[model samples]
Target: MPRLIYDYTKSELERVSLSPDRFRRKLKKAVSNLLPYEMELLQKWLVFYTDNRPELRQCISELQSDHKGVC
Candidate 1:
């Protein structure tokens, strides 16, 4: 089964009122139920959005700075 393991920490989810354990369980179930074609469609949309948008590339740099605590 495919999984959607989030990279965020437990403290991060707590800050957002999302229980990490519960979210992970739900994500596991959802991912297991997703069809292969659904995953392909998601990949297509991701490519389409990122490939066609220059602003998103800039956002990626901003996100990197935020990750490094320099934002």
Candidate 2:
């Protein structure tokens, strides 16, 4: 069983590991479909997964500051 959020699996997320830009796009897509409660888990998972990948972390940091919510 894989970690899922709105039909997206953890592996789907993992596949974009090398490209932080793509990861940001995919994560934004995932976040769009999540309910309010699920957002927290998504954030936590984002933190855990992006740890040690500063570029990805920077992408995440950028995502957080996106008020317009555009990917």
Reference-based lDDT, each prediction: 0.39, 0.70
Off by over 4 Å in 1: 1-17, 40-71
Give lDDT tens digits, candidate 1, residues 4-67: 4322322232243234345334333433455555544433443454465554435434443543
Clashing pairs in 2: none
TM values, all candidates: 0.31, 0.76
Worst 10 residues of 1 by lDDT: 5-14
Runs of candidate 2 with Cα error greater than 4 angstroms are 1-3, 6-9, 68-71
TM-score of 1: 0.31
RMSD of candidates 1 onward, in order: 11.9, 3.7
Local error of candidate 1 at 3, Å?
A: 19
lDDT of 2 by residue, 1-71 (tens): 22355436356678987988788887777667676556666677778987888888987778778734332
